[model samples]
Target: MNQVIELIQSHRSIRKYKDTPLTNEQVETIIQSAQMASSSNHMQAYSVIGVTDPNVKKRLAILAGNQVYVERCPLFLVWCADLHRLKVACSLQDTEMVAGTTENFIVATVDTALAAQNAAIAAESMGLGIVYIGGIRNNPKEVAKLLHLPELVYPVFGMCVGMPDHDPGQRPRLPLELIYHENRYDPEKAKKGIEEYDQMMRRYYLNRTHHSRDTTWSKEMAAIMRQPNRKHLRSFLEGQGFRLE
Candidate 1:
């Protein structure tokens, strides 16, 4: 495979990091690469907050379900889906801005995710390790308070990046046959593939090093579905001034 494809396939969520810190130049380079990502209608409705303060990171770690990596990682980046800037633009043009629409919120969230993926790829290319921290959403309100976020802006997720202290195998993905469709939806074929993949994942989980779990993909998903996961997100978004209409 080509270098680009190989790099993409080598992705792993690295949790442990070395004590070394990334230089400002390297951080800026990754941010610049993220800036190159496509934005919906060229709105660029997103921003990133790089936290280097140990005290703040420690607080964030507690807020993010006691994930120590947030505090220990050399650099922690909080990706925010922002519509406030568009409001500012509308004000400058003497026009009323409709920032509460669900479409705008969706667009801003997508833009933030795409930009973060770009930054992740850039960081990996530079021999750094990174992991996306969705736990940041567990306490979105408090996180916003800690970060001093204004209305029409919210943290979708955070990322921890630093030198690798350990190497982890990439998690397995569902088969291409199950995920990829030709012309239309093929539920039967997808179901068959998933049945076989469930067994495959059963073996994977049992064989994985350290903290091996006795579960299959379907079983794990079922368990997760049975539990409430960020069900308050809609209310939190509403509190942030997103009408989500």
Candidate 2:
């Protein structure tokens, strides 16, 4: 395989980071690479807030379910789905802009995700470790207030980036047969693949945790699906002016 493919396959979520901060040149390169990611209609409906302030990071860490990594990481980037800029663009032309439709919301969110993934890849290429903090969504309203987000804009997620302090081995993913389909989905193949993967994951968890924990992927997924998570996000989005109609 080529180096890029190998790099992509070797990806891991890093939780621990060294005390070293990212150089200004490194930060600039990563952000510029993110900006090059493809966007819907070239709208580039996203914004990234790079946080280096210790005080702000501390508050964000608490808001994100006390994920200490948020505060510890040398650089924390909040990727946002932004429509406020588009609203202004319309105003500049003396035109009315439909602020929050379902399609627009989807587009903006997708754009933000795509850009953030590019940034992640860029950081990895530079030997910097990074982790995406979805817990930021746990208290979206508080996060928005802290970041001073304007109307028609919302935080999509946060990324913590810095030098690696630990090497957490990569987690195994589902087999290709389960996810890849020819013409139509093959349920039988997928079923068999999932069963095999469950056993693999059970062993993985056991080994990774030194026998402290032994759980199958299916079991973990079941636990996750048993309850509604972040139910407040719907109301929170509406309050942020994303009608999602």
TM-score of every model? 0.97, 0.98
1-245 per-residue lDDT for model 2 (tens digits) = 99899888999999999999999999999999999999999999999999999999999999999999999999999999999999999999999999779999999999999999999999999999899999999999999999999989999999999999999988999987788898996777866888899999999999999999989998999999999999999999999999988
Assess the local accuracy of residue 169 in candidate 1 as a C-alpha lDDT between 0 and 100: 77
| Model 1 alpha-carbon miss at residue 195, Å | 1.5
Per-residue alpha-carbon lDDT of candidate 1 for residues 1-245, written as tens digits (9 for 90 to 100): 99988888999999999989899899999999999999999999999999999999999999999999999999999999999999999999999898889899999999999999999999999999899999999999999999999999999999999999998877889998888889998888966788899988888887784446878898888888988899989999999999988
Candidate 1 Cα misplacement greater than 4 A, ranges: 210-212
Model 2 earns a TM-score of 0.98
Report each candidate's C-alpha RMSD, comma-separated, in the order given.
Answer: 1.2, 0.9
Whole-model lDDT, model 1: 0.93
Best by lDDT: 2
